[model samples]
Target: MLHKLNLEHILFLDIETVPEYKDFDSLSDELKYLWADKTKYQRKEDFTPEEFYERAGIWAEFGKIVCISVGFFSFKGEERSFRTKSFFGEEKEVLIEFKNLIESHFNTPYHLLCAHNGKEFDFPYIARRMIIHGISLPQKLNLFGKKPWEIPHLDTLDLWKFGDYKHFTSLKLLTHILGIPSPKDDIDGSQVREVYYEEQDIDRIIIYCEKDTVAVAQILLRLRQEELLSDDEVISV
Candidate 1:
């Protein structure tokens, strides 16, 4: 199925999010109550809401995207190259930039957006964030009444599952098993919140996000039984 689709029609992406506030105290009393309530099941008396705040970035309502990195394949005759770009800084700006890219360039029925675990995470997270900011949803992200086949989205993680609904695979683990370069060499998702809030290193997070995006693309190539992308074939622009 992957071989039937044009590689250039897929925009591969990953996002980095941090808690909406740097600390639990930054939240208003109402939000504090809401946070505690929202995470009740996940926390399960193991940790207080304050202590578990670092993981708040996993929830769209409690987090803001700091960076959204996207990569696309370009072909030149017999040669192919992958180019990546990132939108970072204010959450609204990052989202708006991404929306424009989708609406302007990849806004076609044939174009697809792919990511690892994206169907469950990246895709919905971006849509929710955009809605919160009053940004109109791009056609690709708006899934209101679209049937399953009508959605212009692809998920490598879903492909890897292959009907084994109980199976879950991390991008890093999948890449390793597939013999692709590890995208988590520098920092994993668990450390992203600290990097963004404490280290104030948006650049580092952007690189990590782009690496995941590239890894997602590479995973697809591997699934299609194609050669892995050489370092020279990947360009950050």
Candidate 2:
């Protein structure tokens, strides 16, 4: 049963990352290369890592938190509704808003914060930004030097340990395997910042956030048990 995991107050979340500088001449070659790798994230273009980072700023700036999309969902009875909020723009303002939001409801009866690649990305990203904002992180989230498996983290990406460490697993692939229809709307994560910058449309970003959140939930469901989905679901983001 899903309850076996014993996640009481679960906040499923995903984040959008961006670097502080478009290209930081200050960082050394190693660090620059490291950052360049993340810039290639979810990109379909034939871009070398350097080109990816040079063309687009992502994962630079050490601890710049861009968009924090938190999806709060309770799994118990059949009645279900998820409260999701997204905070983006300027790291300081975003972190302040995110901290306020998290602090406001975190004391409520809840269990854990769940994410797909959160251990590697989302959780630390949020925690570091909170620290930058002089806001303490929620107790359960301050893993601080603990092994991921030893912590209260339920990273769905790591859960898919089908013995292929090198396998490139994605939220979309998980959706396909679990038969959950994805509502991506043909938008790619690479274009997220551009959409935010060019169109200045929060709605598109929110839709993207919803697509990823739903993917996170489905990934969690797959981890706890099997992927369950009814008809009328579409896949493509």
Candidate 3:
């Protein structure tokens, strides 16, 4: 088990998904077919089967990724700098860029990927879409057989759980719990499509994702500090 991780050796990533095609009346039957079991949290009201069948067409055509923001903090002795790279545009092109970045410098032997709920959402979605684009996943993404928890993935949601699964914890809630000030997330996820279409603005989504990356980094810092302090106290005692 990898403990006391070097943040510099970890890749913190987040991805946003859109339908495979867009500007259509109804989602393609094929895209709808791909929508099988992507949901991770419980909604207060159960969606009807027809309602649930929604977004399939959206995912099939454009099936493009709207954004992939990556952030990592590295230390020069004691000073650590947080650096990030965000890709937003055509799914194929954006995915190509994402693949190249992962393949380029992160080509180290192994690096733990830190994400906010990536086990359920981001990781597999990125993998499937990368295959869709005919892009081969990097060698480090070879953590195939391991269960979600078994991998070196650090999910802020799971850590927020504190072992209790009572309520669904959104990233905003997790940030609030950690006393970390989250960005102005007044806009909800449902609004992204409209904002992207009618407003013709992709900046909003990029900004939203950027804030999420910072939140992920902050959560990592908090966890690392707590764990390090705990270890140090044990040593002192």
Candidate 4:
């Protein structure tokens, strides 16, 4: 059944995010109070707000996307190739560029966006950050007045769920179960904030983002019982 959907119609994507400010001390008094309130249930009882600040990246309200890497399958003469592109740097610039790409090329009925846990995380995070940056939401990301079936977003994690809402599967776990190569070998999402703020390594984050995007595509192919693209077939553009 999965084989019936055209691979070229799907855009596989992943994003890396970090706290809006470099540290809790940098946040305004209002924002600091808000963060503490927002994370009241999640943080441990003994952990102070400053100690728990590292997790701000998971919340769209307190976080900003540092990288958004996208991959899509295309053809060159009878051979299939997957190409990836990334938008990085400042939050506003990255959101603007990503929105332009979506508006220009993917704003159509036939194209779909896929991510690891996008329905829960990536898709809405991008939309919220775009709104914060005052950039218009792309047609694909805008959910206003759209029914569930009308939304074109696909989630690899959801697909793996098979209707068990209580179950959660991480992308890394899915890759392992399906025999796809793992993308989290070097640094995982937990380390992204430190890498971005302390190391100042956008390139490393972009590389990580692209690998997750590629892993999403590979996972989908595995579900479809199709051949995974060879390393040579993945081109960065």
Model 2 scores what on Cα lDDT?
A: 0.64
Number of the predicted model whose lDDT against the real structure is largest: 1
What would the TM-scores of all predictions be?
0.99, 0.71, 0.75, 0.98
Off by over 4 Å in 1: none
> What do the candidate models score in CA lDDT, each in turn?
0.95, 0.64, 0.64, 0.92
Tens-place lDDT per residue, model 2, 1-237, is 355754436667777664455445756787777666655555457766554553443342453556767766545486444556777778778877766765666545345677877767777777776776777776656777866555756667766766666765777777788777775656767776566656667677766876687677767765667544332332222
lDDT for model 1? 0.95
Taking the tens digit of each residue's C-alpha lDDT, what string does model 1 give over 1-237? 789999999999999888999999999999999999999999998999999998999999999999999999999999999999999989999999999999899998899999999999999999999999999999999999999999999999999999898999999899999999999999999999889889988889998999999999999999999999999999999
Of 3 and 4, which scores higher on lDDT? 4
Better of 1 and 4 by TM-score: 1
Q: Report the number of clashing residue pairs per model.
A: 0, 5, 12, 0
> Clash number for model 1?
0
Q: Could you tell me which 10 consecutive residues in candidate 3 have the lowest summed lDDT? A: 228-237
- Model 3, 28-147: lDDT tens digits are 565344343343232225763235433432333335578888877656775556676789887778878877877786766556677788766777677777888787876555567866
Q: Per-residue lDDT for 19 in model 4? A: 91
Q: How close is candidate 3 to the true structure, as a TM-score?
A: 0.75
Q: If the candidates were sorted by their lDDT against the true structure, best first, what order would they fall in? A: 1, 4, 3, 2
Residue pairs with clashing backbones, model 1: none
Ranked by TM-score, the better of candidates 2 and 4 is: 4
